[model samples]
Target: PWSSRYGRRNRYGPSPTVKVATPRDIRAFFMESESMPRSDYLSFPNRDTIDDTIADMQALAEQVLLKVDKTIEDQIPPPTAVLEDELPLHYDGLELTNGVTTVFMFSFPDMDIILPQVDIYGWTPDVMSSGVFDISSGNAVAWEDENLRVGLWLHSGWNQTAKMLQQYLELNDARYRREVWTMDEFLETNVIGSKVFIQQYDSFRNAKIVAAVRVPPEGVYAVASHVMDLATYLEETYPGHGFEKIIDRSDVLMIYFCGRQLTGEKAHPDLPTAQQSRFIIALVPEGS
Candidate 1:
């Protein structure tokens, strides 16, 4: 407001004089502001300081996004990690754990029923083919020392039976005893029952381990099942088979030895298979 004066003021104590704006200056400024260079009147903070602050903020945002992406990436395991645990399950040195209930060893045979004691439900007599054991169902299990290519299921959610087999193969005994029925006994026994499950796999050298397991006709497990025409279902879903009849005379269920599920979904049929997903299912029936 003092700049309104026309005359200037002197510095105090007569230290060399200094001029200060008065009322006249303020009036002159308002009167000529429109014609004056506007930027001269409008001052902003230094440009370098503002630019540095904006750059700092952008860098901080980028760092935050990078950290978030890294954390999410670490949370999931790529499907390939299962390779070691899936094939040629060597139960002799297998570690023990109690969190899972059943275990299934595919790609090998345990006909003698040794090591934790499993009844043979399915066998591949072709020596070159993979064998399947109905290791456990609701807690039944078995173990053996045969040198075979085996995969063990170590956990239980839908496939509790598979976990039971894993426990035994690890040399840890399973106590629950469910009979390992031949297709004849199993079909005859459970045919009238309400719950039925079919597990499909991408069986191979480095087996996919578990392809899928669920109650059929209602869940995604429905991918490959038909009450009578199993061959077509297997071909469409798993895409390959080497079937053999197990129980030749079953009034209720016709059991067969289904061949291997190959390594990859799109892999060639002969590309080193793992589990016998069962085409029509060639079977070495129980007690044979």
Candidate 2:
């Protein structure tokens, strides 16, 4: 694991050890139904069933991991050094076969359409320019933290959104052979590499993208953000929840819907808890 001592000062205390999901774990997602095959689940599942499918994929991953030969050390070496506030770009690549062909697609979210967001109307300059940007660019599924709770906002429809992304990638996989990337990439530089990584991830699931937020000076704790569009939608959705307003939808700023639900046993379920409360995500090409 890339230690926190390598990055910015630990005023937040020891950085929580975030468990990164491996490529195999991601591959396991596409392997949910042998009858349907990998692409079948990755590209065609409906939203209503996406979450259940994601769970099924996770369960299968656990089984696959249980059979791994742990005694055999990984051939990949860990990073000896890294840029400040950057995660060691370590990776373990796996050939995610569609059981037939491995391809990738790159479309939608024209970069020309996404420009840097400058000052907002009345707020301090901090909101537009503080902390690392877009923590979850290519995250097809939410990750779990050390607390065994989820790491990103997930509600009834987000899983469907995730599956939609998976399907979107499969739709254009006809051009590539394989993919490679790490889920921990954001731990190093949260904002800069997002768009490009997501582009590749969507093309081939090369990177392990997930909902990411930084740590507070007080240290790691659970938090959530509801970056959504439409006034009526927000009014209807957050009827009884307690959350602060981060941003209002505008032509310049795009909003993504993200939030957390209380699990019976867990205290904090939000992933990548950080100092910054708002997580600036990359351009989402598709969603629910």
Candidate 3:
């Protein structure tokens, strides 16, 4: 042995303290080897080599989040369907004809026509003079709440008539009410955007015809006057047929009288029995 004392111990406790590597330092040293090829870097072969790998991953996640937020903000969900399997169709436009205006028509192909159920009548002094029963103002005098009964009447008969006509056309049966003249429900439902006419039979006579036509966006005039003209035409053309009273008959004659001023017009020399007529007729034949 050379000098064992010199090699083993010196003046201090030991020659010098040899530094032992810490776990953190060893891990760091191994992590640096990730960039090399798999064969060259055995310690951390699959690990990322970047110093701030965690920060970079967080930044990329934030970018993805921003893109998702933008997509959600820009897009709107589509509206849900209300009437499933129903196709949108526009109704036919009606034309003013024969002095009478057609207001609406409700019919289906190979099916019976749906008659109107409502009508509205307007009241004025001129109409009162026309000898038509003025149901305008009633005696609400006792109940002092400014009781006003405007010239309005509910015609159930008219509604019944429409229903009866519909039934007749659909069932091919004539067993229906013959006295159904007016319909109040139909008047209330269909009387939209209508005009009130205070028609005078004669200026001096003070007689008036208070009526209104239910002017809908579609169809024929729902007025007694127009109905009467149609009925007359049907009776003339079809002759001795009860079809002149139904509302569903196509090819039924329709007469429209327009621009006939209500003042001082010689009592329509042609309509001699106008006074006796209580109801206007709208005729509909069985097969037509």
Candidate 4:
């Protein structure tokens, strides 16, 4: 059971009725009404002069609209420079004890936007007590990998962010889609086998992927391990749920779990400690 600061309430005992306008009265009122102009119309000097003035005003309006568009575009930091300088990294010797390397990639569109930071919590009880692996560790690369994996699993919804951003930019500039790509599709197609790519949607038509390596859970070996198990369980127990199998071996496995744990020996539900979790693992074809 989950609890929140705000909860819904329902009142059952309510009885009140009031009569207002009848259908006959409403129909008679509308039948006697007449259509009228909202305001008095002003007459222009001459047809020729009115046409000339209208054309001039139209040109001025177009210029003003263009200037506003340029001003908004200027505020968004350009992605061309950031993408050129920061490329994805690949590692070889740094392997986790579980034999699987977790890779994470984060994308940022502009310098003004703040990217999400990562925090790693181990399965051990002593891990949190020492405060060693919390969010504020100087090891950004390590934390980034962990948090990126967690983000991929926890924030797994249909690519609404990409779609909303696309619609917004296209409203002002018709050429937006040619440069902008969906973040979900970009990660799914590009970094499938090598790393986990996670990113945020921004106002501009640009994106970035920050990459790092992570360690998998105790028994999990490859990215496909947990996914395969979950798929099998769903198929066997709840076949009616229509959970599909992983068609492409290149697809990554992202998982998120939320639960509560008992503190010490007390098992009170109201006082239990809450836990939130996320993990991402990449899977490649057997030969690849």
Best TM-score among the predictions, by candidate number? 4
Q: What digit string (tens of lDDT, one per residue) describes model 2 on residues 204-233? A: 332222222222212222212212122222
lDDT of 4 by residue, 1-288 (tens): 001111111122234121122323322222221111211111111221122376656654554454345454443322111111222221222221111223233322321222233322211112222323221221111111211221122211112112222222112233222122242233334333332243223211112222212111221222223332333333353332222333222122332321121112222222211111112223322233
Clashing residue pair totals per candidate (backbone < 3 A): 36, 17, 28, 4
Error of 1 at 137 (Å): 9.5
Error of 1 at 63 (Å): 37
Residue-level lDDT for 272 in candidate 1: 20
- In terms of TM-score, which candidate is stronger, 2 or 3? 2
Predicted candidate 3 versus true structure: per-residue lDDT over 65-128, tens digit per residue:
5433534323322111112222211111111111111122333223334333222212111122
For candidate 4, give the lDDT of residue 234.
33
| TM-score winner, 3 or 4 | 4
Off by over 4 Å in 4: 1-123, 138-183, 193-288
Q: Which residue runs does candidate 2 get wrong by more than 4 Å?
A: 1-159, 164-191, 196-288
Query: What are the models' TM-scores?
Result: 0.19, 0.19, 0.15, 0.22
Report lDDT per candidate: 0.24, 0.24, 0.23, 0.24
TM-score, structure 2 vs. true: 0.19
Question: Who is ahead in TM-score, 1 or 4?
Answer: 4
Clashes counted in candidate 4 amount to: 4
